[model samples]
Target: MEIYGCSVTDYSDRYEERLNLYKDKFEDRDESIFLEREMINFKDFHNVLVSIFNCFIKNNDYHKLINDPQFINHLNHLQNNYNDVFKELFQIGPPLLDANKNVSNPDDIKNEDNRGYIFYFDFTKEKVDNLIVSTKRILKYLNNKKLRLQKPRTPESEEEYKGSITTKETKPPKPSKIPAKWHALAYLIELKSKGLKPPINTEGAFIKLELEAIGRIKTGLKGQGFYREVSKHYKDLDKPEILNKSFGKDWKDTILKLFNSNIVLKEYIDKHY
Candidate 1:
């Protein structure tokens, strides 16, 4: 239900129907499953991803999601939904080390418990620790991005008084990243703008093509001959595999590079196109 905001967008009615069917099929049913629960937990993963992107990617804040307790709790909850709950997620207190040894309490002197054996934790903590280190490095980079934490002016300086600006330097608003589901639409728009032949046929066909390409919906409406005419004049028009899976992920980046300097086209893309 809450899938729209994170990554994929512009869901077709048919796709939505398929999504719900899958959801119903998995829920409250005892069946051999490997990745079905993983798919359900995708919603949770996307939630965490969206929040992290907002705090880190959108704002470029020095504090990453790794620093947030709520994020940790959310991730832990998600893990509990599928992970083995018997295992410990973390050890609170630091390991007491007098030397390269496990310091045992002399009062509860148990010979087997005092044995010098080092047991390693599971992959979960390893992943979390890696994330922590990575976030620290990434935050350093974010902080280095042109003095990230700029202080607001209180009109203390003559320049500030003369300018009478209400807030700090406001950069121009960037165009929002177009959704992956709408990549076909955006591609069509771009083609039309450049006076180039449209890919496949109509908008409906392109939408179906995109959904099938990304494994979203499988209606088997194969239009293999749709690109016949287009393919004669150009390469890659006929190949259904031309748009790889990451086509939607980095489609904007790829398309924008072609018209990055074209201000008019860029504005049009940000608005109507």
Candidate 2:
């Protein structure tokens, strides 16, 4: 399954709590955090669909699939035919119902590279069952293959789909996203530069915020005392009215509204420094 594009979120217990935490927090938000989790869940849900379709495709008989060149040829030959049945789905690089597909826009992928992709789709149970039934019908339609491998798929035939989707709608355009992983850090830097507080806390709070910003890509930050001199910093901005006026919506909407924004750590000298 790993070789076949299973993801860390699919297998590991390590990130489960964090992932589920985000799921619960962002459940009602329009933000990508919740949506991406749902999409990944949808992708994983298709494992059963893949298994059933693949079983029939590989072997007409329920219990067995063998290394016969005939079935292999039948699968390869129906490339053009399958696309017809899955007109909308096969058109993009979604991990939708297509057993063989890749990301339409690799850069738009939201997860880390080590984790598999999160593919957004309208994954209602009815839709999936519809696709399963359609695909199965096609497979059954193709089951009476009177001819065997006339010739293996040409290099050109395989290459054709590699470039694009089989449908008329263009691949979904790349969505706008926070430009970098340090989005939390960059936003925090901006907040502190503006002389913000609530931003004010103990040194530990500051360190925790800084870590949230630059988690994997560690860099020196202004050490604790730089920002946590809570006495020096004016703390009135922690009020909801001011927060709503500050960022407009997102920050104030959540319960962690106060310090959920990033924190400060002293800018320590490092090799990069």
Candidate 3:
């Protein structure tokens, strides 16, 4: 059975672990020494990373791929949907050890485009499942990292950067009036207009946060609880009678107006919320 838009089986149990590792790697905090027994190489992993990003590029949905919770869920669903393809590919491979046994140094495998051989067989259901966990974790980390980087500079930081020493204490900046949903909605609609599809998974963490910020849902909801609430919300919205009354008959036009403006969604959301 499905909860919200996600199947219970679709989520990886290793999501949090993968997320932590992804953050450590992204921030250069991971100092763990590598071991040959790990059964994967830097080159092989790097190729997977490249392949993931390349998929986004080929679809012309890199922005959505990174920052859109729905899009991320869509990617997860796609990966899950290809289970048969993965199983079939894994059936035809000679052991990778045979290829590596001759090489004393892993570093000797330079500038190698081994994705053709590696991807085809390297991913058993279990291995791909682990990789899927890592992929989602990394995507979430990168998106949040990008958001943090885009956050507006505080007055104190700005002043310190300018080397201005003021004898007078500075007042804190006023809170912004904008809500987080607008930013999410704006981006979502833009991607839709561009013919990019987002996942039906409205229960994802980012979407939960956005909905909570708008007072449309309660805070601290997650997993099955989160999915149930969002699913109920969507069920309500799916009724044309309710939808028309809530957004008016021209809701699509109203939404288009909100998203079509050229303002940077994240910047405005950051500054305000």
Screening candidate 3 with a backbone cut-off below 3 angstroms (N, C-alpha, C), the clashing residue pairs are none
Q: Write the per-residue lDDT of candidate 2 for residues 1-273, one digit (tens) a residue.
A: 111112333233333454466446433222233223333333433434564355445554311322344534433433333433243333343333333543444455456631432222223223445655543443332232211212233356666768664544434334223222223433343445544433224552543332222222222232233233322223433354644454455542231222343333223101111
Tens-digit per-residue lDDT, 1-273, candidate 3: 111111123323443454466345434212111111011222233244345544444444322334444434443443454434333433355332233443323344443433433343234333545554554544454444435544555675564658655544444334334333333344344443344432234554333322332222212222234333343434333365764664467654444455464455434433432
- TM-scores vs. true structure, each candidate: 0.20, 0.23, 0.23
For model 3, the stretches where C-alpha displacement exceeds 4 angstroms are 1-148, 151-188, 200-242, 250-257, 260-273
**C-alpha lDDT score of every prediction, in listed order:** 0.37, 0.35, 0.38
Worst 10 residues of 2 by lDDT: 264-273
Which is superior by TM-score, 1 or 3? Answer: 3
* Candidate 2 Cα misplacement greater than 4 A, ranges: 1-31, 65-179, 184-273
lDDT of 1: 0.37
How many times do residue backbones clash in model 1?
A: 0
Model 2 RMSD, rounded to 1 decimal: 24.2
For each candidate in turn, give its C-alpha RMSD to the true structure in angstroms. 20.7, 24.2, 18.8
Q: For all candidates, what are the clash counts?
A: 0, 9, 0
User: Which candidate model has the greater TM-score, 1 or 2?
Assistant: 2
